[model samples]
Target: MLRSIASTTALALILSGHALAEETTHDDHESVTLYRVFVGDHADPKITAFDLDKPDNRWTFETKGQSKLYGVGEGAAVVAVQSDGDQVNFIDSGISLQSHGDHSDIDIEEPEALGETLTGPRPFHLIDHAGKVVINFDRGGYAEIVDAHDLSEGEVETVRMPQARAHHGYVAPIGTGWVTSVASDAPVEGDKAPERVGLQPVAADGTPTGEVETCTAIHGEAFSGAYLATGCKEGILTVKAGSNGPEFAMLEYPSDLPAGETTGTLIGSKSMQVFLGNYGAKGLVVVDPVDEPHFRYVELPFRRIDFALDPANARFGYVLTEDGTLHKLDVLKTEVTDSAKVTEPYSMDGDWNDPRPRLAMAGDEIAMSDPKAGLVRRIAKETLEETGTIEVGGMPYNIAVVGGSGMVHEGEGHDHSGHDHSAHAHSHGDPQIYKGYFEDSQIKDRPLADYAGDWQSVYPYLQDGTLDPVWEHKAEAGEMTAEEYKDYYTTGYRTDVERITIEGDTVTFYRDGKPLTAQYSYDGYEILTYEKGNRGVRFIFEKGEGDAEAPQFLQFADHGIFPAKASHYHLYWGDDRAKLLEELTNWPTYYPSSLKPDEIVSEMLAH
Candidate 1:
């Protein structure tokens, strides 16, 4: 789901061995070797190679006829495929070239042709394991699995949901094969459009209706041991890996939370929790599947452009904010540890599907896809330093790098006189980070801190009810009348109304410790409301009008409604109260149309 990409390469190194000999004895800090990043341009259809130690320098590799690549998959090896097109290429990361030491020796194979010619549309995503590739074509609505090493023939899995329209989908290889989202169901016979878009509005308060569709297509997916978190519009469909197939469970958000929500992006953590992005709220939300099936809402500081969890380091992950800063977030502590500006501002205005840079982690390098810059930014995780770069021809959208010296060249290859390192200079950056050799015993316990852009810090505290704000009304629920109380607590409200006091035909509302006054009819019929920035709250009461003095009171939630006397009414007697009037006018637009006013109000108070 990450798209930002830029490529710039540099060469620099720190002298080692003599004075640093003392630090080498320390276990936590060990010098890195054989670090490289594979970045694909966003504008062009090319993949660039960069040495992590020296990111400023890189080499660009043109794909088969310069076809646009949509996604990159990395496991035992790295595979890049052209979406909505036919073709796939694979390279050997096991060998290192000269600049990358003798460890990197890339063996490139000829690009393989897809089975079907111009079938509906090309592939949208590439799922690769070992040397196998599964390309899902959105237009055809079928997945073709091919041998990446040799694509002469392969297997094809057809996802035929006669009632579904495909958008973005993925296939899981290790666990369950493929599970798609349900975007739209088919119409009857020759109907132009489908009867429904598979979305049924729940309580306007943002509660789950639990309505199941005949079919669904999830946009994105990630695997954690045995679970696959599928991002869907209705809710996350939790798929548990089973011997038969993945088990499906739908989780919805609680109704008491704020409205406007959708889980657009999903990433599973090692701790069994799922990180989800709410496109409606424009913030990152964390959901503990074990705690509650429904997701919990936690607001973020800014819009999240791209994010990823580090499987190696669970304590923290990096988030690239819209402002172009790489924010190192402590997921465990739920706080930002550090941030640095890394790119130019790319507004989220224009098209919703516009191309933008994204974040990715490859070994010790934090690879940033800068579409505008047409380059990839490589930074070291430990020092947060820009080690190198790769200048790609077009904008790079997504990247994945995997390949490192396994045993630190336990053999004596240095006995040679001349080794060609310049050929790799254009692809990798400085040779220093990957140049010097290290003893395996010297780095046995060294931290994998060198892995940048993809590293995460672990959450120290247990994720559960502790992080949620306590609901004070829960403990005192039994004290109220069971019948009348049914309408007392607003299970959910469009706005947070702390309290409302009512007396003989008059009412005065208090919001966050401030008194608000308004007008009504009847002998007293009083009303009061207040506006705080974007928040608007109102209180309706019927009691004898009086001043702030000994006004009759009616209890609601933690708030009290009192009589609104002449003095309070005069403050808002005319057009000066336009803000409150505007808010009330628009209240119904967000209120649940499915529920009655009394039911809606009661649920808000109780929630």
Candidate 2:
């Protein structure tokens, strides 16, 4: 659940070996995981590593006295927490290699400890925040933060629940502080849950700031964009970003749901501000922080085994039922879109520590761990088909993947730092609903839409103005007025979309009397590529729909080899799909000569 990825986006390693023999050059290669899964054996002190490319081939490593693996991720490093009382250790997940070239073979090495911190009675939740790892010592009533890069020892901060004893505490880092549950001042009551719990903003320096926010029998928590959702007895607590710190707003439990309703587990969207939460055992609930009245609920036939969201694919996530069926959750639509039985029913009427089915997302695949069967079943993306399974030698209670794509130069002569490409900073920035869009042939048909008409375009230029401030949300709850929201979000589209005829799959975006046809390539995200004089242009698609009916608006960004200071253009099909022209158009009065406008173009252009 916790993945501590190193800053790989900023780090590059050389790969070619031919450089010493002659002059050489290198190109950029994006990060990728080499290994598929690391199954944590509960029956023994070992973890089995599975190759994504070759599932039959596997490797097992001994973890000594540790009986569990908490945070196994494909990030730069994997973390294993050891609870050996006062000698607890947070050790290395395993050895993984990264390169700067196009491709590099996976390296195998012995496992060792990354570092150590307070060896407490028990270290439970291991969360990866930003780039650091937070280890929660439940027994010690403290949370320790360690630098993910070096695993250096960090300060341990105390936490206390105001009314009831904190059986298990949580800590999530935001900006320079943490959203933490307080440790109770008194011991927990017998065979009884906490009547009320309190949460507060805790600074990185261990001091509590802002007013303490309270919830009843608080449990599940999740984060997305500028919003953080925490589940409690009443409903969900939404913490919004703020200049002073984060502020909490309570959303009461749904009125029609009746009594005895509470959320035990929560998973937030990777981009949108919506959360998938467990409503006791009745069913699953999709809670929107801003819009709470229309909560989407999907009932379960049996109890839940485990559920997880696909970090890379925003459209669908999955839920594994105790009946062994994996249901595909159309997140935007908030419903069960597809389902398949992955394993035999694993009843939930047993001890909490009993081995059961668990779910996780390994890249684009949905992996289900069948602890009783000692197997990990993977579901392919898009198709919702069985991709096959991998066998671990023991009870695979937990699984995590470690390894990413990298490159190595042939010769030592090439300077890795010398490969300077156009910034394309807008596209390079992290994927956002407006900032990026990708369409894979596997996800949908060749073309998503067809248009042939004169589309009007209204262009807005900040003129030497950075879109950052307009796009960034600094409010406490990620909530803004209609006017405020439109200002920042509308800046990405053009109001003046001109002549364009789209009839079926044939889309001829005319440029200077010539047509730029759509041809697919590159990770399926780049929908089409066309030539503009000496430079080439690529169209990428993205949607920001939080509903399952599909994205109401399609976002396409034009990524070209253009200089940063040069003018550029990006737009979308007008909001009205019928005529494809009547959409909201707002004009920017100021256009500075230095900023240059986006080239949407001659007969009109692609998003």
Candidate 3:
């Protein structure tokens, strides 16, 4: 919950203020619809609200709560927690009171406080499911649930499983509710607490017995239908809460693979599924607990910090990279469709525990909460442009988005009484009309056209310490000299290249600038491989006529291993083979250095 505002984070606003500041000149008596972001300042223990329609606008809300609360939950209202572990406050998300408008008066209300009742060993996580807020205490191994509205009095269901030592757990709303237990045992005399907790399953009454199962590092849980999935070092723990309540099963990884760990997880939004991230692998393990327990792997360049399924479009989900880029993935194809740079390099160079930005998708907006900047960047779902930003006080850790259809009423009795209050107007100047100029004229502007299909950049740096290669260069409306061809080819060679010899297709050259050879026609089973030195090369090819254009079976004579052929396929360690094929197919799509060391190796192998 570190919330120091980065005074060094620079904001350059060079666009014409007149264009964006044009007055709407609405009916003075009519209630204006507004969505305001309220942020809690960690350093000052203060809260402020910003008008989403006007970036330069702000309002301050008084808070006697804790100064360093990690996550802010937005429900039918905005919930703010005090840093001192004393109180929680709620702000109406519906119609934010405007300071300059007719609604100048501030609407403030203090509900209930946790008081001394909340001061436990440690309040690790504050989670909200439905309207109930639960605070988990690690020291006491218990959970306290609160009525989100009242905050003072609610049900406190405490389950003391003897082997439960809090690591990371999540409470999901099923038929009732269930908490994932981080397996642990009671303290023994003269025995030091082990680094990892060996699993001892809880019986029907939440009591551990029987043989100790060697399971450690049980992270969070996500619910999909009757199944609740939890990520563990062994694989995944699948639980079903049905007629019999909750039943548990373990889905382990392939034994033949190298020993790595599994930590991160995200349940599939549409199906009876979930995703497990192998800290050791480059790809994501797609888990369908009821169907295929073994899971399938979807490879990508960077290790995903977080991902969100587009509730609007189930085929797509976004993966935010450490380098501050959001990658669009087609879940159906299990392929990356596009990517765009959103923020400056936060980097993966520091300690894994260091503060960084996390991503969350709220309605049509995709937001990244940058703890270092003390800002929440709001990206438009369609164009992915930074449409707006609000300054919050404390470092935001976890965010839960609810109440999308939320609306504001003039008063509690302002409910619909056979009357329509949505005053309609169609001005010639729709906000979207000037959106283009707004983009072209701004420094941080992102164009909508860029989102048509998937966009990818080359791997910025290769394992060999060389730059990525590029594939093609046009001869500006006329034929060029042989020297020009050679120069372009040399440029492609210096960089990594994606061989897209087909017309109208765009390909990238690696950072080093290696040019692709002439457009070659292929027929039958034509296999081409590229390997620079010993490591294998990963290449993406464009479909063309015949088998030559089609993928081929690649085998390395030195290693005696046949690598699979597909434009987007995994190539772990094919020294000479990777280099030659990359030389044969498309140029390099430079991946940023933001990916972790192990992630890069895994991504390359999977490709």
The model with the greatest TM-score is 2
lDDT by residue for model 3 over 282-333, one digit each (tens)? 5665566766535666665765566777764666677777677877777656
| Candidate 2, lDDT over the whole model | 0.49
Supply the TM-score for candidate 2.
Answer: 0.58
Could you give candidate 2's per-residue lDDT for residues 104-135 as a string of tens digits? Answer: 32333333444334566466666664445676
lDDT of 1 by residue, 316-428 (tens): 67777677777776665666678878888877777744667777666666877788877777777655677766666576776766544322221223211222121111111
Among all windows of 10 consecutive residues in model 3, the one with the lowest summed lDDT is 446-455
TM-score of each: 0.50, 0.58, 0.49
**lDDT measured at residue 489 in model 2 versus the true structure, 0 to 100:** 39
**Clash total of candidate 2:** 51
Query: Which model scores highest in lDDT?
Result: 2
Error of 2 at 339 (Å): 1.1
By descending TM-score, how would the candidates be arranged?
A: 2, 1, 3
Please report, in order, the local distance difference test score of every candidate based on alpha carbons: 0.41, 0.49, 0.41
Error of 1 at 407 (Å): 1.1
- What residue runs in model 3 are displaced by over 4 Å at the alpha carbon? 1-51, 54-74, 77-117, 126-132, 147-182, 186-214, 255-259, 267-283, 371-374, 391-402, 406-607
Give lDDT: candidate 2, residue 374.
80
